[model samples]
Target chain A: MAQKVAILGAGLTKFMRRAKETGKELAFEAARMALEEANMDISEIDCVVMATAPDMFDGVHMKGDWLSDGAGAKRKPYMRSYVGGGSGVFAIIHGWYLVASGLFDTCLVVAEEKMSSCMPHPQGAFNAIYDQFLERPLGVNLLWIFSLEMMRYMHVHKISLETIALVSVKNKRNGLDHPCTQKGIAGEYTVKDILNSEVIAYPVYRLMVSPVTDAAAAIVITSEHEAKRRTDNPIWIEGVGWCLDTSYWTNRDLYYPKYVEYAARMAYDMAGIKDPRKEIHVVEPYDPFAYKELHHLEGLLLADKGEAPKLLEKGFWDRDTKDGIPSCPSGGLLGVGNPIAAAGLMKVIEIYLQLKGEAGKRQVKREVKRGLAQAWGDLMQVGTVVILSK
Target chain B: MPFKEFIEKLSKAKVQKGDIPVWHLYTLGIGGDVFYKGLKEGKIKGAYCEYCNSVILPPRMYCEDCFEKIDKFVDVKGPFIVVAYTELYRDLDDNRLDIPIKVALISVPYAKGGIIHFLNPYQEIENGDIVKPVFNKKRVGSLKDIKYFELKK
Candidate 1:
């Protein structure tokens, strides 16, 4: 019913604990790589969509405006999308419409995060994310909220720490193959390592958490005809879905992510897939924490509610396998380091590589046809998904 | 590279810290204003949405699911139960607290939204343990009016 859209090229910089580069510099590096991969100059871009998290993380207000020049939006339409960490894939969804609506033939989507600049730590800014009058006065660390949700899920599903720890081990092991990974926390994190790591909340460990990172990623999406003209192998943007539950996090059941399921359903419906569990072969559901990847997997309906941990135990998503489903084969934010919106975009870029057989060492050992990537954010309220196929 | 590396190329790298003072004002809606004032009177306020048959604490103006206007202010009687609890050993700066802090989300069974705040330092609490608000001697109609939620005797 709409104009067909496909990703022409994708590029990203190394995920770092702290990048020496500024946000715009990071954006330009990624944008240049993307344009180069597409073999199209920046001037050929019709519009720009910048995906970034909060301004507090970068310590710069008016981030979309500041990133314009670097993103090559010097005189073109520039836009920004922020839904906490979900902005990355959400930006791609916005770009898909720009092309699918017949508005523009080519759209440049770039997501950048400079979290190191936030003094004290990036976690400090999150305190403001709660109610200023009520929840903030309690002086809660953000981990407490995750722990609350984790505990609720554990109680309902009777999930064990070891089962959850497998996600950390798998993603970190996968990270060893990613060239642009953050060095420190990127290697040799096993289930034992996760269990032995510092426990922030009883169910959550430091090693199980994705690091605060500074990085950026960019992807060029164009009309299907333009994509075929530009590249020999084009990854079609098959579907997109983004949904936000109410901001009242306390009111909802934290044990499940209904919003994520809603987003995935929308994408699957648009892509004409009746069942995600069988139709989709590859999955990358956001992994800011080990449990989150599993949580989002259930939300994506790749597994039934509370069944993702069991799937992990069965090696259903073995990253090295040729027959099993693979999730976060790019190492994910768990190993690559999470730069908020950029990490989500990195997942989009990962699927692009997987579908094009350009993922190099990080590529899954399988006959890849279609894949799903999703990012969750905003106190567990927002879910954004993008599906791509060769 | 750390900030020390900037010393070698001062002109090329300008590291700016966000220390400037900024102030923000929020106008509490009718629901919030009523809830805060009710706290001063040693009362917990909630709203009932008949369409959803759900009660929300720290009352909101509209129902999240049904989108119905909430005009019914109900007193949320508690002894609320602890839904979840966590021990945070350090603050955001990674500083070890002299004594670890215990926090939880206390919920009145009838209400959908509960209070996320500190648990009583003196009480031993667990999930589903009933807790009551220990109000401050002086009330400013703030969330802090309740010192902490204590394990109900």
Candidate 2:
């Protein structure tokens, strides 16, 4: 059996639409914060694993080597891994192995994205992701696929625009409590407001989307003995799971994410959790879009298939609910700006802080022990999951 | 704080610049030849997986879910439904669009995927609206062969 691993520290930078810092600078900032919080020096990190999505975003190739120094991995054993947006949680999984295998006493994991570096519009960089010969000629941007998925999801679930809009309202409201909340609007907005917002795509309004951002986040994980020696409080990694569906997204049903379910099952099994709805206390599932929270909630099996929209109507996934659970109390990518990989890493950081009772104003009202964080990326292909317990 | 002097000194540092200047040419793979040829003939070719008894739009060589090789080609039965639509307020440069291009996701009935393209009509386009492909008089084996999908009059 692999050795147990624990998170010594976590760090996050406030998400921004644009940052003066380069990718390396952002990585260094987050890494420095994490190391400082752990009361550990950069020299102690035995290895480093960096996660960032798309070279296009940073306008750099061989991003791992370029970012290594800023991530505090200068002349240290280092590598990078990516599964598109899923890289955040996937990096955690990679770091866990480094410590769990006893090959390294500690590992520093960081995920950064700088979408602003891509010229014209960051959305244009996504053109390379499409089928060069077929889908490329359609003049499709990233939002078109999301709109297509939203339309299909609504059609299959018989979902209403009102219920979907509520997700935006509640999440943005939750954002007010999170220090990292980056939704640009200064005041409160309602479902009616969301309904009246500019319709970028039918069934998807401007309010429903997560803004592109430039940001970074980092975490330090150590072996059990090292964790005990390093800090009085160490959040335990109970389980980790990742799964990837074929990239041919057009061949799969858009209404449900079977891949996330597959990943959730693996993590839950490792955690010895047979019932996620009852066993899990908090969630920070990827929510780059408002409806995505519902979609991923179902994928996590927190709600029944097509049942999230109805339950959301009853405030089931609020930060504290008499009948249900708290989710994305950190504001999630819906309210927090999305810098792709950093957004996902921030979700993990949220869970860690919540479990540590250091979440400040965004802390859930209910007592929490175990929490789950997940990320989805690619053509809805990659699903990465991590379980943390206090 | 002498920041101005520091800035001037930093600006004098040598800088190096380079560009890849590479272009990519991608083949549509096994299933693409038939599909593009059909496009030139003003027909939308869809892949039929006999094993799954289903058809996929924008055709592929295999069924991603079932992992079955798809060798059969079929014309997507139309009166395509406008499953979704969007109006773009900004272009690639993030500038507000002058005429606000209308794009629609049109699907052949019961197909798993659909084609995303510009729509001819600017207003009153709703989900479930029946649409027909409008082909150009001059044929080219490309997506532009069909100018746009128009609501069937």
Candidate 3:
């Protein structure tokens, strides 16, 4: 049997449009802060795992090798793992196996991105991720594909744009309390603001999308025995799961995220969760776009397909609502800024903090014992999930 | 399947060639900004790593050896030593050039890493020979500002 694993500490850098720090420096800052919070030193770590999105974004090849020293891996065992945007949450799953399998006692996981390095715009880097022979020939960017997904979802569910816009208003409002939220991205905004915002690709408004950002986030995880010896407030990693759908997204129905459902089912099975809607208290689902929150919520089985927007209108996903499950209380990618891989890890860190009662103003109203953080990416095919409990 | 049939089937498959239509605008990060700006001023600079007791060329924000933050940058006046040299008869696109271009990995004195730049075609160069950078008259904050390196008198 495998030993249990637990998160010891977490750290995050402020999300911004452009950062003066290089990718290495950003990784170092987050790693140093996480070590400090864990009351540990570089020498105490047994291994390190790094996660970052495409090399095109940073304009560097083999960026993981370049960032090894900054992540405190110096001479220790180190490796990089990636599944595009899903890398952040997947990093935690990777670290869990390192300690759970008794291969290492402690692991430091870091996710960083400098999307601003991709000149003109970071969206261009996303263009290169498409299928070369088929998708690339169509000259499709991220917004175009997401617009298709959003349109399909709304059409099948018969959801109004107003209901979808509410996700943007709620998440951005929730982000006002996040110290690391990107400037100008988070604040109180009305649904009308999101509806009237510049339409990048019909149905996908500017205000509804997460901004391009540069940032890093890190967490320290250890074997349950080591965690018990280190801190009294260790958050256990109850379950972890990930899945990837076929790369030919054109063949699939965009109305639902079956990949997320498959991943969530695997995790819920491992955690012995029979009823996610009632058992899971808080969730931080990937919400790079407003409609994605609802799309993912349905995929995670927290709501019936097309039922998430209805839950949102009832104030069920608000941060302060006692009778509701708070979603994206950390402002999510919509308000917190999306630096690809780091955005997913930020969600994991939020769940860790909320469980420990360390989330200053971002904590939910109801008592929470278990929470889930999920990330989706790679042509909208991959889903990574990590379940944490106090 | 027979060899002729397999070849015929393969020939019938369609192949498409395309390019990634994206341009990058990279920010010269913390240390790179200092190093590149110094080049524009007709100077060479390297970041000082106190723990490693060495200066690293192409200055970076952190020392790879000691893994410590590097905050000090010092001028590097060098009789650069040629570590290696290569002559290319073709350009990047594989087109024949009018004259072969000589490139060398030139190491600075007391610095950990070195810069690779064009070696003056007119000068006779060999490994371990001393050289110095000849700056461009109209300097830009780019690697191109260093026109080439010539043999030291």
User: Which is the winner by lDDT between candidate 2 and candidate 3?
Assistant: 3
lDDT of 1 by residue, A92-198 (tens): 99999999999899999999988887766778777667766567667677788888888888888999999999999999988888888997867876688889999
- Rank list by lDDT: 3, 1, 2
lDDT of 3 by residue, B1-153 (tens): 656654468778989898755566767788889989999999988899998799898788887666567899988898789999999999999999888899988887688999889999988899999999999999989999999999999
Ranking by TM-score: 3, 1, 2
DockQ, all candidates in order: 0.01, 0.01, 0.48
Give a tens-digit lDDT track for model 2, residues A71-144. 87867889897888888889999898888889999999999987876776788777777776567667677888
Off by over 4 Å in 1: B1-153
Better of 1 and 3 by DockQ: 3
lDDT for each candidate structure = 0.85, 0.84, 0.91
Residue A303 in candidate 3 has what lDDT? 93
CAPRI tier of model 3:
acceptable
The alpha-carbon deviation from the true structure for residue B9 of candidate 2, after best TM-score superposition, in angstroms, is 62
